[model samples]
Target chain A: MKKLKLTVAFDDGDYVVYAKLHYDRAPNLIAAIEKVVPFSNPVRHARICESEWMLSTPYLGVEDENFSYPDPGDISLHRAGPHFCGWYERISPIGTTDIFASVASEDLEEYRKKMGRAWEHPGAKMTVDIVEVDA
Target chain B: MNPIAQELFETGDRYLMERPEDIAAMRSRMGTRGQNMTVQIYAFSALGSSVDAMYLLQEAVAKDDYDFDTVVKFAVDWLSTLAPPADGSQGAAIIGHRASVHYRLDQLADLTSRASAALKQATTRAEVREILQALEHYYNQVRTWIDLEFPWHELAVKYAELMGDPAPRPAP
Candidate 1:
């Protein structure tokens, strides 16, 4: 069977995280996410949520002019491996941050926890609000 | 042939005769000039992978009741981080010579937008085929760029070293 691919970019006023996903393995990954949260039409709402999520953690902060998205030429779908992959940059504060601690330890873990709770009941759709932040 | 070129040819010939999969594996292993080549290959590989992923999602959207927005976002989120390890000054030269990393990122964003649109409207098989074909073309272009930049011999030597063998051919 062929694989399914999707890409996402989050502009948090100061930074952008570009990501790609393989849908074949994670068919419900996105829907599962939507079930937990709703997308705010304006980008800033999500930004604030991401920021709030980061702020709650000691290791996370918004950086200046360090934001980045994926290189256009660098897109692809691997036959086997992680379902998704991509790069990110700090846009506002400008500096390198620890990936394991900032993303894996704090943000991703939090997301997983929240998602778990939202998914506790079958077919429960979580409402996510994305409010646009001023650039 | 240039010394580097000659070594690459010998290495490739030896690998073809004895270790074919090793040749492919060499492309993935990092370090030295081979790592540089691998980065270039990876840049292209990213494109091919993106296309493959996009095609898959398009197919799913067509036949299944999937959340299109969520799926697109999921794909984009992953695509944004597809980078080779930030080592190798040699590879940096190649990547910079082509364009700064930011340029590549912009291109990816544009492609993602296109893919998102295609997915949103993907109701027929032909449209999906077209999107996949476009991705295949993008992949081919990346391969061509790699070929032009590294040629076969330098790539072979790099591959040989990456495979943990001493430079496959003796110095001229």
Candidate 2:
């Protein structure tokens, strides 16, 4: 099986998250993302669903955008910038995004809880590093 | 005015007024999905407002859904026939420079080709829908591009004259 994955390491690389790019489903987005391998960012946590879901908008200069209604653990690529919105609950975007990747390894509920608890500490931040996860 | 140009003006106006409102709702419900999808949809929806009637006719008459594929192939094939981008800051160039447009359009071509390939291999409806979402977004980009530079007749004529390809065929 062909597996194309990205490692999103955060919190000083302590929390390692692995996601698989659905190249077959979102070829344009995957292709655009593949060009900019090793996309990483450290941004203030802005909870979208839980008290922990990180909202990041790192511009990767890619133009392949989409409207993606994703389930829990799915990651969306915003239109212009390299924004990320990870779904952590029974939630769906009112519209859609370039839903390019999915978090397959980590437990969504657990990740959310951990992130929620960690966020309680003042000045808590999440550094997300997305790199190619070779299979 | 040609029907294409007329339609473009009318279509663009409708979306320009309507989509912005939808954007807020979408953003509120879906986070950045609103921020991203609305920009894409409105831009294209505006452009689709004024598509070339002939192209629309072709799309209507065609037996297969080759619209996306055809558009991608045209953008790529036409660009390949020209010289590569010249040296300079990509942003420094005039917003409407042929080379600059080609540079970005080339990227757009790659994006569309990838989407087309993915659609061919997609299995589930969910997968197919996402692929379509991406395709429509990019496809609108080309349209939005046109919408930005309205009165395309001048641009079209100038393109023909500069490229010296009066008979350059567009993909069907």
Candidate 3:
């Protein structure tokens, strides 16, 4: 089986990171995310979820899957506005979210820096796309 | 109406009031400088309360036909406040970046208008509940944006902090 990965590109592929999709745990969510591959949005920082940045995806709507507190590097979908959230550092427990993917450990440092900038200078453009990788 | 909701409606009435009268008061408060985010914040906060009142009313007024009309009246009254000042006096008093303020105001008005239209045709408690739910969603989004994105300075920052996320509650 091929592993699924999501490429999160910021500022039109200037800075990019790969997140391994948790298909085993959130298959439906992953599938829904795949359908919207190459999703583009303006990213903003989360006030409640510390060390997290979010992108409003008003277009994406899917049922909750594997919803729980997010750890650093975990990417999840929050159904309120149906936004996508990525936690780059240990965060306060705000509520549960559908965890579907995670940025690889090696990418955490850069991811943290990139997502952190949103706290001060937000509205950066972010693009997400699904890609196939070796299992 | 629930007692708490009734109290909230009265509070909202004080903040919003009728047009012309409240508009004149608001403009006078803005004065020549026209930079009063404080009053704007107060008005929006009161609107939040009114939205809550509508929700609470729905919870307890499911059996009362008259209660729905009361909720609709309160909603319509508050919705009137979102309209831009008639004499183009809105330029000075707008908080934050002008374009952002204008865009958000328009978006909020659009959402409210749609909800208002749907609410007019609604005949049952379940229908009203759905409308209130949409308004509640809009309120939370606006509140969050105000606290997180609005340019708060000095005392306003305290208010913004106070308005933070309503914290850790499950999203509806």
TM-score per prediction, in order, is 0.29, 0.36, 0.56
Chain B TM-score for the candidates in order: 0.41, 0.30, 0.49
User: How do the residues B54-120 of candidate 3 rate in per-residue lDDT, one tens digit apiece?
Assistant: 4454454356745767776555444445533223323333233221233234444544554555555
Best candidate per lDDT, number?
A: 3
lDDT values for all models:
0.32, 0.41, 0.55
lDDT of 3 by residue, A1-135 (tens): 334343344554567677887888788877776775665555677665677787644234355677688888999886654467889988677788888888888888888877777665555666677766665
lDDT of 2 by residue, B1-172 (tens): 3232233233333332123232233223322443333344443443343223222322332334545455433432322222122222122322233211322334333333444444444444444434333333333334433333233234456778889868422211
Please give the distance, in angstroms, between residue B26's alpha carbon in candidate 1 and its true position after superposition.
Answer: 22
What is candidate 3's fraction of native contacts?
Answer: 0.00
Q: Which ten residues in a row have the lowest lDDT in candidate 3 chain A?
A: A1-10
**What is the TM-score (0 to 1) of candidate 1?**
0.29
Per-residue alpha-carbon lDDT of candidate 1 for residues B32-143, written as tens digits (9 for 90 to 100): 5535555556555565465466446545545547665565445434333442212221222322322124224333333434443443345554454344334333333333
Cα deviation of B77, candidate 1, in Å: 3.5
- Name every residue pair that clashes in candidate 3: none
* The 10-residue segment with the lowest total lDDT in model 3 chain B: B11-20
